[model samples]
Structures are given as C-alpha cells and as structure tokens.
Target: MDVDDYIGGGSGGGGEALIGMKTVEAPDDGSNCLICLDGGGGGGEKTTTEAWVETPCAHRFHSRCLESWAQVKLGTCPMCRRELTAAAAAATTTAGEDVHVLVADPMVADPLLARWNLFVQRSTDGSRSMSSLVRVLAVSHVLPDEVAAGGAWPPPPPHVVELSFLDNLQVSKAAIQRLFFYDGGSLPPFESVVRSLQSSLAAVLAVFLPLAGKLAYLPEPGDVVIDYSPDAVSPGVKFVEAEYSGSVDDMRRLASDDEHHTEAFLQLVPELEVSMLPAPLLAVQVTRPRDDHAGGGGGAVAVGVAIHHGVADGQSVWQFIKAWAAAARGGSPAGQGLVKLSRVAADVIKGQRTRTFLLRADQIRSLKRRISRRIAAGEPPRETASPVTAYVAIASLVWTSVVRAKPHDAADEAYLMVTADCRRRLRPPIDPGYFGNCVAACYARANVGTLRRGGGDNGGDDEGLARAAAAIGAAIREQLEDPLGGDIEGWLQFHLSLPAARLTAVGSSHRFMAYETDLGWGAPSRVELVSPFARELVMLLGAAGGGVQVSVSLDEAHMDAFETSWFQTAAGDVTV
Candidate 1:
C-alpha cells in the first residue's frame, strides 16, 4: 500500500480514531484478518467482500472480529500485541494535520516501509539515513561475554600509533569494506548462517575486544582511547542483518567488472555511523540475495564487513575475519596478541572513477624478468635495495603508467606512497596476530619526464619501470629500518602539502590472503575492496585464482589513459 494511504486527514478522516486507536479501511488484497484467520470476513466464511479495519500498527482484522476482540478489554492488536491506541494518538498528535501511521505489509513491496524500518533500527544517534536498496532486518550490539556479564571493564591505554596523525586522519573517512561471496548450495538455512555469524563474532570479539569498543577522545586528559568502560552505552560492535534487493550475480559482476559500481557495493555494507568521539569502531553486515529462499538454498550469500581504519589495518582486519570464520565452524578462535598504535589524513575527490585490472601470474613473472634484465644491464640500483617482488614490480609499472597518463610538467615531481605493515619492523617486534593499526607509509618520488622517459605509448618502457622500482625499493628499505622515526608528528602535514594531482597512494598488500577467508560454505569466490577513500588510491589483493587484482581510482580521462597503458604492458604479449 502507498504511504499516503495511511496518512489520515485532520479530525474526521477515512476512519474513526478512538483515544489511542485509529482504524482505517484495510487493503483490498485478500489478506487474512489477524483476529480471525478468515479472509477478512470475520469467522463465518473465507470471503473477500467483508469489510476490514487496520490498526495503527498496520495489523488488519475483520471489522466485526476487531470489535469482538476489543470487547475483551484488550487494547492491543491480536497478532503483534502492540498497544494500538497509544501509537495512533502519538501519530495523530505529532503529525498535527495528518495522522502518520507506519504501514508494514509483507505482501506489498514498498520502499517507504523499508526506509521507516531502517530509520527506527539505526536511530540511536539520529545521524544515519535510510537506504532504499538495502533493507535492514535487525540491528544489535554484540558484546564480549566478559563485558556483558556486568562488571567494571577497564579501558586500555591508547597506543601511540592510535594517537598519531595517520590514525587520526582516518577518523572521518568511510570504514574499510571487504565483500566476501559464497555459494549457498551446501550451506545450511539462511537464518542459521546469520546466527552462526553473530554468535561467532561475539566469540571472536572477546579476543579482539578493542574492535567491540569505541574510539573516544577524552577531553580532560587530551587523549584518545578504545573505550570499553562499564559506564559507556552500547559498548560493543554493531551487527546488522540486511537483505539486498539485487541478486548474488549482480554483486559478483560489480566486483569483477572493470568499471566500478561503487554505490551499489556500498549498499551491501552497513555504515559505521561515526559522528565525533564515542563512535562505533566496527560494524558487520550479512546480506542474503532476495531470492535465496525462493531458489531452495542454492543462491549466494555475501558477508560484508566494515572496520574503522583507525581501529585496525588490513592485516588486523583479515585476521579477525579468519578468526570469526573459524569460530563459526565450531573451532577455537586464534589466541589474542598484544595491541599497539600511530596515524595520516586524506580528502575525498569528485569526478573520480574506479577500475580493476588483473595481472596474470605469467605476466607478473615476465614483468619481473624485464626489470631484472634492466638492473643487470646498466641501470644502477639503490644502495640498500630490497629484492624486486611482484608487488614492487607491479607498483612501479602502475606508478610509471599513471604518470604517463596524466598531464604534467617535465620537472613536476610525482610521488608514490606505499604502506608497509610494521609488525616485524617495530622495536622489539609486535606479534603478527596483534590487533590494531601498525602500518607505516613510505614515499618515492620522481620527475614527470623521468617517469615517462621511454617516449612511446606502447607501455614497454623497461627502463622507466626499473628506475621506478629502485625508488620504491629504497623507500621501503629506509622506512622499515626505522618505521617510527623521521618527523612522525608532521607526517600528515607533509602528505597534505603534496599536490594531490601528482600523488599515487598504494594500500592493502597482496600477501593478506583475502580469498582464503572461508565462513563454512567454502572459500569466497571473490573478495573486493569496495572503498578506497582517495581519488589517487590503489588497492592490491590476491585473487581467488593466482596473481593480483589491482583496484585503482582516477578521473575519467586519466583512467582511460591508464587502462590503455596497463593493458598494453600486462596483456598476453609480456616479453620475458
């Protein structure tokens, strides 16, 4: 039914309004009356000609049956048992001229109902709006058993990494999203999957408790903390159960397609709903295809996870995912490790488009060979250089190709920012399973002319690739030697000072086994990094098959040039 149909006109409208109860004509669709399971024909016979009345909560009943139900001195609907009178009176008073009632009909496919439900579910802080494409079924906080048992839960000291500018910069950005798709053929019922995910998430959150806490800035002490105090309200991770209108294939296509449909992918995940301090550090959404049940359990299901970048880096996030999956399968979660910190900031750009490019294993090997040949011949290498891994080679190729794609002056400096996991590089070394952000950003720079030196559009510029690789290798080596050194406080300012047009930031290493995250039904057919906040950002992930899946965002024109250069370089014709 249309939403306007539920809005009553002034005092005397479509139906009578009793103290707290308002009754309207029921929809003509042959829906059974809640009071009496007859077809709105009271208890006599199943007929569609009988008159029916709808309560404020949208429960419809035969007029006579409802009158009989009211005679029993019950002021509630027979089906849902909601107070019928109070809801109608509040709606009448709040809407003034029109009595606005929320009409929820299972038979009707109404976006208004979906919007209303979403608003009510996430209205805790009143900062989030309703999403039309994704309907929220339920929203609940999953707290660790220790904290939920009711006692003072002490807050941990803020890690220096968490307070650093790098982490602080991510406070206002969108949560990092990773979508995992699975075939539902062998899986249990959809409800069972959701239950397992929630229960296991709680089990896993006990070990990684910080993820369940909030990122709060204490004004008195002038420090930020992962708050989990007993006094805090809803001190737990937000778990959302949602249903996506699109099919599983739709999401798969969006993930694999060269052209990115970001908005569609964003709808699959729950928003973190960050305002100021005390915002949720993590939120998880499990979405089942609308037709999953209709297909008798062969449809696909997607698990979409959103974690605040300030709370955890890629390694920590994946570790949590794998742990949650293991717990879901009745296995014990990985043991908890020590926690630590540091930060950087960036702004979102407009008119940018994202595209994914695949580099086959053979192509990667060929590119590495070409770079090796250049280094062996006459090109000089950095003094303290690291071996040219596939990442180094691919990053260099992308950096050089992008520089050639955009318009830049010959002497203009083009910068490449690469992030490295600092777990092993830190003093005393942090455990690999340690929770929280432990990543440091390293930078490489070269003149525009030097990046585009080969002078041809063929994209076979081995010399340029060699030079770019050397610069990146040196940057990584220098940054790892002292991950926390060199003007750490000014890191954000330094990056902000760089020209956005000439910067290319790389995120998410291929070593983080994303596809290996299995939630019982088998490994994910595909994994996608849906959100790259910066326009010049690039994300590299290990594909389900071999090789790396590179997702890059750039302006329309620049992306076109980059695609041409990229395809020519990594296409089947890679020279060894």
Candidate 2:
C-alpha cells in the first residue's frame, strides 16, 4: 500500500509514458462528463480545459479516473491491457525526480487481458447476435447530480400514474437486446473498458435526469409518478458488465422466445421491483462472448436492456437505448433498425399492392353522425352506441367491406380486430409523458353472410353496413368490461392456431411515437415491427394530411379484397 510500491520511488529517467496524459473529445450530444457522469453539458469545452484522454481503440476517459486506476496497474491501459505506447507522458518529469513512469510499449501483448477478452470492436456490422453464456462481473448504479433540473433525488413524488386500461394489461416487461463484436484487434484491460462506460453513463444522466427515478406508490393516495428529488438518495439505472464463454453462432440460437431459450439468458434481463409499483424504470447488461473465428479480429458482445412497463413504453425505451449507444460510440445514435420488422411472403403477395389514404377529420364527424342516426332507429345499447367515435365507424366499414369481398365458405368466420388507446378514457387524464403500455383491443365479429357489403348472400339487407358499426361499438364496450388476465397459454395457443388469412391483426399503431428518436446516430433508416410470433398482422401509421396509412399483409387474393374495401368512395381518410 506504500506510495513507492505503487508509483515508483526510485529516480525516474525511464522515458516513462505520461501517467495522467490522455486524448479527449468534446461531448456534443449533451452527455455528462465521461469521468463525473453528471458534469453537465458542453463536453467540448470541459473535456479540453479539464483534460481527457482517448485510447488507441477510440474510447475517451477522464484523466483523473485513469490516475486512480493506474495505482492498481501502472503499465497497462485500464480498459484494454495494451502497454502505454502512443503519447509521451503528459506530466513534467525531470531526470532522477520521484515520478512514476509507464515505460511499456502499448502494442506489446498482455496474456491476461487477452484471456479475459477485454476489448470490443465498435461497429454496427450486420452479424448474428452475441452469445448468451455471459458471466456477470459487476452491477453499479449511476447517479445524477448537478443540472438545474435534477431536483431532489430519493423517494420519488406522491403523484400516482393511474395505470391506463392498456397499461394494466401490459404489466409484462419488454426485453430487447443489441449485440456488438470486437473488431479483429488486441483487447484492452478490464478497467479501461469499464471506466469509459461508467463515465459516459454519467454524462447521459445529466440530460435524461428522470430515468434515475424509480416507480413507487405513496401511502393513502396510491398513485405513481417518477418520484425523485435529486438528493443523494435518488437512484439511477443499473449497469452490468458480463462475459460469455460461447461463440457468436451459439448466441443466435438462444436469443428468441422459443422454449429452448427458457431463461437461458434471463440474467441479461434486468429485474424490476414489483409491488405497490414496479420500481427501477430501467436496467441494462452488457455481455461479451468468447473469441470467435468469424470477423477477422472481432468477437461478439450483446447489450441487453430491460425497462419497466410502468416507467416507459416500448418507444421510450428505444429512444433511451439508442441514445446510450450513440454516447458510447462518441457519436449520435443514427440509423434506425426498423426495416428488419418486415417479413413478407413475397410469393403469396407477389402482385398485391399497398396504398395510403387520407380521411378528413370533418368527414369522420359526418360518419359518426350517420351511425348515430341508424342506431336511433333501433334499440341499440345507448351507453356504448352513443359514445362511438369516427374511428370505430371507419373500422366497421372496412371490416364489413373486406368480408363481403372475400369468398368465404359457410363455416368460415370473419372478425374485425380493433384496438383502443386507453389514455383518453382514463378518469383523470394521465400525463402525456407517462410511459408504459396503454392499449387494449376489441374484436367485432359477424356471420359471413351479414358482413358482405355487396354479396348476394346478404339478400340486399343493411346487415353489413350500419349494423356492423353498432357491433363495433358493442365490441369496444365488451373489451372494456372483459376481465383481464385469462389463461395466457390458452390465449397464445388460440391465436397461433388461427389461420393467417382468417385474422387481420394490427401491426403498428399511430401512437408508436416514431420519428422522435435521435440517439446521436441521426434518424433510423427504417422503423418496423419485425414479424410477430403469430400470423396475420397489420401496421397502422400516421399519414400526411390527417390521414391514417394502413399497412396490411395478405395473399394476392385477400390483398385484392382488403385494398378495394379499405377506403370507400364515402370517407376520404381518418385522423392518425
């Protein structure tokens, strides 16, 4: 523990590398100082004046943290175990002065670092995901300090975020992951790698200050808001560093929802505090797999991210993760990875076409009135029918029209799958920024004969048109009243057993919050829901001019019918 034992007490003429010397980059993304994590914005000015260092591998670190780490191992890079080779020592050391010198060459190989596989290549190369055999090394909490907005830290606020109908049903946590591999090169020491990550996280906290807050319910009120006053007690995200002993191929096979994957990589999934309220808005794990022969010099590393449903919705999680990655890469989060969501059966949909249409807000108003007028003639459920909106009206029209156009056998059944946004229906409107799932769905069904808009089976009755709208209203009410949480296994099995063409499910929603993510990499190249576990899905997007863009997938036959009936000559479009 003596100073000389760690630093070098003897005369120092050893041409030693600068102990505190480093290369630094200005933080342009409003990230916290790499060292302090919450040093406030303006990385460019602070990094230069305060002094930062960039490793040969391109990671930036604080000069101070490096000095502290040097006490443990003076000659090797705290991150990658490379010997100090690049820049000359920054400290002014005179011959025979009592100064610690790192004289080792940075390029020299170190077996220990190599055995641990300490270095990771920073590239977005399209490859299989990293392995699942990760060994967790440590878990650290990154806190927030500074920034005028970081308010008081611990025991969040008293305001409760009443769970929307959709949120209550979606209590399930979303598990997402991104894998990175080491570009073919020598690895750095473990300290160097962890140091950069820890510091960069500090910078992120300064901007996204609320993330450090957890989910909790106060005594009598029993409500929830991201309760956090930024004092010492406030909590932040948990960062975990893990190592995998397997190869890239082994990882690809294990990262799915299949039974074989059964909690295999569960450790990668962050745990949330469930109770009065699910706590810890977010948790993350970085997994590094063993060396692989593929990619000349790189091995795989998988970054697992877990976000509590009460804390954030899927879109919000996407935004935060991308931001973190961009900060880590020393650039902005650019390039969206949504294009991979599409898995079209080209052969079946070969000649089919997809189109976008607009529906004016006023036109929807008129349609709503039309349905109400028809309902007035019959003994419709006033409670539900009276409250039906233009959205339900349009969905009814499309659903009935498509069924009429299809060639269904007597035994074949048709259904209109519709989802509702619970945000507006809540007693007291929840905050717009409130996270987590807030959607519920309803199914409106009718006999094939009653659904054909122009088929001879209808006998020219009005059963399919106006009546379908009423059924849609009833279904909406049904969804609201239906008790949640049935046998999930049965529910999943039922959907999977259904034929792809028989059911038309929504793919994406207008509320998906697209085009809002900018993780320093710029806009994503593509945004899409990769194919889901089941068949027959649709994607609904907000289109230009207050219209809704319907992205549907079907065989050539069904596409012809669905497209023809999607937009009638009556309604122009619907508000997204």
Candidate 3:
C-alpha cells in the first residue's frame, strides 16, 4: 500500500511511539528500483556482519550467503517487498486513540452534521486501505438563505443512511477496492465540477430526507460523528488530482489490477491531488466534460459509495441520492419509487409469526450436512436450488468446473450471480436507517450455449443464448418483486440468530459492488468486481456515464460471444 495514500484521510494522533519498530523505508535512488530486496547482493565478502546493500531493493544480506539468499528470496526483499515504510511503526494498541480524525470544514459542516449520526450506525463493510481509485467530489455552494443574505459560502449539510445486505453476506475489502482503475483519464476541475454535482445531489437530498424521516436507530456513540472544528487533532480533507488520457482498453486494464491501480491513478490527477480518506463511505468521480460537437455518445462520470456494511443497503443509498437530488433541484423528487423501511420490517415480523415454518435444528443440520457432503464429493446439490438459491448453485457449478471439472463443463460454463438489495421485500418493511446488510444473491448458469445465440435479427448461432439472458433478467425481476423467498429481512434475521456453525455451513456466494460512490465529477468509466470474491458468474449494476451499467463475467472463451449477444440485446431492435 502506498503510505502517501493515507496522508489526507488523517493519521498520526500524538501518542506513545513503539520501540524497535522502524518505518519501512524505500530507497530514493533515481534508478528504476527493483521490487524485491532479497535478490540484490554480491559474492565477494566473507563475514556475516559484512552485508551487501542495494538502493531501491532495500535488502541486506551476508556477502557469503547472498547468492543462496537471493535464489531463495526470489527477487523480493526478505522482510517486505513494498518499496517504502513510515519513519516508525505506529505502536498504539488502543483502537480509536491512534485512529485519524478528519476535521470538518464549516462550509461543509451542515451536510456532515445532517448525516454523521446515521453514519456512525452504518457498517463500512470492513474495507482495507485500498478502497476505490475514484474520489468523492464535494462542491461548495451558497445556501439559499445565505445567498439571499449575500453570504460568500454556505454551511454544509450532511446525511447518512444504513446499507443493509439483505442476506447478511460479507462484502470483502478486495471486492470494494476493485471498482476504480489506475489508468483512467485525468481529474476534472474540482470546484467547477463539484458545483454542478452538489447542485444536483442537493436537489435530490431535499426531496429524500424529509420523506424518509429521521434515522430512528442511532447507536449509542454512532459510527460517524461530525464536528465542524473537530478538535485540532482531526485530520482535514486532503486532495489529490488525477488525470489519465489513454485508450479505453488501457484504462480498463489498469482498473482490473488492484495493487497498482489506486497509486497509478493518483499519478494522473495533476490538478487536485488525491488525499487519504478516513475510511471513505463514498467515492465520486466526474470525467472531463464531453464535447457535444464530438458526436452522439456523451462523456461520463462515476460515483462510488463505500458504506460500512453495518449501515445500509444499496436501496438506502439510492434513496439518499434521490433525496439529495430533489433538494438540490428546488423540488422534491417523486417519492413513488421509495420502499417503506418500517413497513418491510412489520411484514417480516408478521410473516414469521404466521408461517410457523422455522426450520428445526435437526432439519437445518441435516440440510447442512447434505450440502457439505455434496460439496466435498464434487457433486451438484439441487436440494437448495430455488431461484433464490440459484446464485449459490450456479456459482458452485461455475467454480467447480473452473477448478476441477471436465473440458466441456469448464470450457462452456461460467459463474453467474446477481446482487439483490432487500429494502422493498421485507414483510412490514424495515426502517431506512437500519444498520445492517440486507442483500441477497441470485445466480444464473451461463455458458456460450446459455447466453450467445438466437435473439433478434442476427441469428448466427446465438439466439438461444440471447433468449436465455433475457429470461434470466426477467426471472431476477420476478424474484425480487415476489416476496416469498425474496423477503431478505426474514432470511437475514434467521441467519443472524442462527448458530455460527450452521451459518458457515450455508456458505453464501453473494458479492457486493461498490456502485454508490458519487462525489461530483460524475461516475466511473467502468466498474468491474474482481477476485477473492469470484463466482462462476458475476453481475455488477451501477450508475455509469450511460444509464444503469451492467457487466457480467463469463469464462474467457465465451466472453466474446457473450459481449456480442449482450450488445445485440441492448440495441432494442433484438427480440430476445
């Protein structure tokens, strides 16, 4: 991780320093530094105390043992492969004491204030240092009252909502970090762009917050607390401008690689530098303005929201955005689309009480064992294969095929899964601020045969595939609209109250996409969810330069065919 990445988010609370821990240092030598330190050594010296040192490699070894060490180390420094380290290892054992606190600017204080309490209650899905390569753009705008009074700047208004993962699946750190790319084009003008975004978002917020009501569930200390002048100890917002001008594929490639993406991305932001964020709950990016004269397609911006999983669900994030937009536009957004959170909760509670269909412990255990055995024996288990459970099944088919199955299955099939947010499906409905994950997984089995043929006009052996994809989309829409198995709240509560062993036994295959990041510029060029979070089929839905952007992952062999089929379907002229 680049240490520089954390500078802006705030770090280094004055405290006791840890001894014997030196900050890992990188060599400043002008040479293109070797990534590894272990391999740099000479053969001439005799004593163990006498060691060979390399510049950027930053490794030292006894001269006599250099060759063997280098051979064994395989070009990496034995201690750490990262090029640089801090001056000293931070030695604080206390969690919050050493944690960096960001000072809120009074200008943005109101916005931060309006949201911080709810922010504290939401879980951030436990993302690591590397979150998204995109950044949130906060615009400075004059409040209506302030403008009326001839004020120069307006106080900020903050808002926060909990994101619930319907089925209680864990969203990994790596998955969240993969949303942005390192090689995308340059950063846009901050103030100028933010002004537009804030304008839009504020209009939305005005409509949303009041309709949603206040967060009824604020934790004791809450997850996020905003202080306009949060003590001098708080770290202020840091800025890093990023800009990149390259072919689409190059940017796409950079976005694909997690390790180098963020840092490499920072290099491109020449104007407003990228700064470290204190566990960002959101990331926004606005691309350079598109030239209307250039042609039909317009340029785009990306917004990514990285909320603590403990907080809200995608639907909640969407709701918040709608509200912000309404508020900014001087009119409330149509609240017709919102799913009442409280009603969802009430419905779930009543359903559970009425159904009396709780699984018996023995039944649960038996089911677990059966699935476990099938998993171990390398067999497809159909017992749990409902449409709601299809994601896991399809994922199993795809993953298993990828790792151990035959050429036909592995070659043809690819993992396919859908992300389901559960705000509307709850029984009585849940509250908007309910801090927990309320998401579900829906999986589809895909292969060249499943998704590439026979759709609309071009029937070049791909109609069947196109038809299948359309059916899959329809199925997803149906499942979500139907509450029976789609009631994510009930499923989540059950899981939450279940035994740990049983919970693990179920082994969910859902993945969360960090798609809500919106900070002004616009939205990302493209967002792809990747590894340690793999499935036979992966589906990502996000707001993009274009309308809602959807990307599905398939095996490399079928990718070309799938892309063709998808585009054909998208064209609207296709029947599939």
Better of 2 and 3 by TM-score: 2
Q: Candidate 2: count the clashes.
A: 62
Candidate 1 — which residues are off by over 4 angstroms? 1-131, 146-166, 233-235, 294-296, 336-349, 381-385, 453-461, 489-493, 573-576
Better of 2 and 3 by lDDT: 2
Clashing pairs in 1: 20-85, 21-85, 161-341, 161-342, 162-342, 165-343, 165-344, 166-343, 166-344, 167-343
**CA shift at 247, candidate 3, in angstroms?**
11
lDDT of 1 by residue, 1-576 (tens): 323444332221112333323344554443355533335222232344445666666666655555434422234455565554433555634332333333321112113222322442343224234445666778888886556655434445442224544464344345687887677477666787887788888777766666776766553443455665545435577788777767767655654567876666666666665534466678888877766654325667778888887677788788888888888878877654322332321222357888777777877887887777777766745453457899998898789889989888888888899999888887787655666667888999877887776523244557777788888988888889998788642564365445656788999988877777777777776677866566578898886456787888888779888876676666553211
Residue-level lDDT tens digits of model 3 in 151-213: 432233323333233311331111122333222233344344445554554344222322212
Against the true structure, candidate 1 reaches a TM-score of 0.70
lDDT of 2 by residue, 1-576 (tens): 222222322111233443423344544443443322322233122322344555444445444434333322344454455544323332222334332233322222222212111211111101114543445667887764333234543333432344544443333222222222232233234344456556656555554555565554333342333444443225566888766566655554443212123233344344433322335665566555555423223333444555555444455555565566566657533334211111000011133333233455555565566666656656344444646565665565566655655677645666666766555555556544444565565666666665664311113333455667777777777766543445543443344333334455543455443333332223322233321212244555443334444444444456656655554423443312
TM-scores, all models, native as reference: 0.70, 0.40, 0.37
After TM-score superposition, the amount by which residue 146's alpha carbon in candidate 1 deviates from its true location, in angstroms, is 4.1
In terms of lDDT, the best-performing candidate is 1
